[model samples]
Target chain A: MLILVTGGSGSGKSEYAENTAVRLAKEEDLPLYYIAAMKPCGEEGRRRVERHWRLRAGKGFETRERYVDLKGLALPKRGVVLLECLSNLTANEMFEPEGAGDRTVEGVLAGVRSLAEKTAHLVVVTNDIFSDGMTYDEVTTLYQERLGRINRELAGAFDQVTEVVCGIPIQLKVKGSSVI
Target chain B: MILVIGGAFQGKKEYVKKQFALAEEDFADGAVCGEEELYWARAVLHFHEYVRRCLETGESPEELTALTDRLIRENPDVILLCNELGSGVVPVDAFDRSWRETTGRLCCRLAGEAVRVCRVVCGIGTVIKG
Candidate 1:
């Protein structure tokens, strides 16, 4: 099963995803895996990683640091896996040394596709960072455009989709309904 | 005035455009332009930015409140679009806190006077007022 959760900065979507994955793991009697996409290059990044570490400290999640190439991740054949975020993954894929030359929007989507196919239950968290209604430079605009398209695609491809606002989760897609 | 709000990239602009037939020229961004020029806009998309500017310029929220009143009085069909209530943890910075608080208050004031209010989620609009 593929679950997509999205929210803006400071939203509790990350915490929500973690808890949801934990619950799914327990319910399905599967091991929980935390896929950390961030490279933690700066102080803020490191602090964020530590904060997340503490959040899932006792939640039984084995962390896998994959800053790029989701397709290369080797997860156990079947288990609950939370791709902690998609934004960082996109940035890394777009600019990281490994993907710099060959990566495209569809390529990133394909990477996520592989992760979904390889996992028993895939819960992905993504950031909805662009709708500030402010125009940006060409590069930022391109990034936002790619992410927006990817988000729409993910929402359609997943079994469930949700958007978290101010710590509240609004179910955008649910099983057996075409509402989202 | 009509208030339409949704999360980032939730198709709020597209919804407004398709629903109200508001062309790009018809809708003005609040992030740019001066205070007086805002009143001249047919529709002010992202009303929060105007409020942000008001706060930044050391203008009182009351001044914004009055301005919204004048805008509504001048243009009976004006529309406002704001990101729905801050749906995340409170900001740590004093300026951010004030901005969020002031934006919330401004949205409420505008909504209070709005003829219709709608919350859009996932391209779906739910009428909260009117």
Candidate 2:
């Protein structure tokens, strides 16, 4: 199953996703994978995220820290994969002056689709940018446009789509439910 | 206020500091590594802290809103710096993905508030606003 969690800033989307993933692992007895998308630049970034790991899983969760293409990590067959946020991943892909040429919308869609097919369960967290407001500048406008497109594609692929408001999870889509 | 948006390693912070003649004492700089000492270091560090705070508190929009309000209130020819993290391939992992999103939002928010905005590519600051 693929799940997408989205919300504005301070809405506790990350915490909600983390808690949900933890529950799935502890109660469901499934393997858990937590992938951090932030590039560990210096000592502080690394240490801060390390603290986050200790706090969340108590050193039990298998954590993979990286700043490159994420396809390298193989998803376990019978476990849960939680992608904390989509905004950062998309930004990383879209801002490369040169490498971005290799990444097309079609290619990203294909990858996400394949991942959904391969993973037993996948959860994705993203910021709801539209709710925040709009931008007038070109760079920002371009970023928002691209993010919207990516979000739409992910929403279509995921089996469950939820938006968090004030730390509350509001399910927008579910399997076999057309009310979304 | 001038908002500088560019990719990592681009001298957006340094350029802004030079333009404003802002000294180390005028602003506080926080980075992923620690508190930066130089103007450039502080600038990059500020962006890093912005991202970190958003991630840790899950309060990116609110923090940005407050910052924007503060900048407007201060109105001291502010120059805010940010990394344009959305110009590459989509990250497959959650953490990297979150950073990309947060950075993108930061740039957007800053650009919206900036009287002038520029995107530095190849050491060239191309005007994207004003």
Candidate 3:
């Protein structure tokens, strides 16, 4: 099953996604995996990553750092995988030296699709950065556009899509509800 | 207590006015209202701005918690409208980061005490809790 969990920063989406991964892993006895996409750039970035580590310290997830080219990452088949975010991944693909650059949409979609095929329960966490209503530079706007398309496409393909607000889950889609 | 939240320009004020039948004068503007005005206001708009001002005055997180506690104790029926500010990219400035996190935490606390919590999107309110 593919589940998309999205929310604003500090909206508790990370914690929610972690707990969900743990639950699914325990219930199905699957190996829990955490794919960290954010490249810890500065002090703040490192601190944020450490905070997440502390939150899931004893959750039994085997961590994998994949900054770009996610389609090549190797994982055990049928394991429970939690991708902490798509925002950072999208940026990495757009600007990183070895990232997809202009082909970010296809690159990211292919990576995610590959992960879904390899995992038993895939819980993907993404950001809700589009609603801020701030104008940005051309490159930043392109990044937003690309990420927005990625989110919409994945939401349609995934089994469930949830938007967490103030730490509460607002289900935007559910399994087999595509017809509705 | 009631909590209403959404992104900026999402018509939160209009929804509150229509839903609660509150007039313009019944609301306190958090952006410029005196701090004391919160204690007795019927409803507050831009509550996130109020939080920013509190932080700007060096109000510690603990003190802010106490102030909100007093708000609940003094006026349980007050309604709050806070923009969902944490959805954007993490700000580069230190103050901006803390401000965003602090507002989010405060809203979480308020949501817990609130008897009703509604999230607005495009001027429509969806009750997430009651």
TM-score of each: 0.62, 0.52, 0.89
DockQ of each: 0.05, 0.03, 0.61
Model 2 earns a TM-score of: 0.52
Candidate 3, A136: how far from true, in Å? 1.4
lDDT of each: 0.77, 0.61, 0.90
- Report the Cα lDDT for residue A153, model 3: 95
Candidate 1 residue A118 Cα shift, in angstroms, is 1.3
Deviation in Å, model 1, residue A137 alpha carbon: 0.9
Candidate 1, residue A57: lDDT: 96
Report per-candidate TM-score of chain A alone. Answer: 0.95, 0.80, 0.97
DockQ of 2: 0.03
For candidate 3, give the docking quality class from DockQ.
Answer: medium
The alpha-carbon lDDT assigned to residue B47 of candidate 1 equals: 73
Could you tell me how far off, in angstroms, the CA of residue A137 lies in candidate 2 after the best superposition?
A: 2.9
Whole-model alpha-carbon lDDT for candidate 2 = 0.61
Model 1 residue B24 lDDT score: 91
Which is the leading candidate under lDDT?
Answer: 3
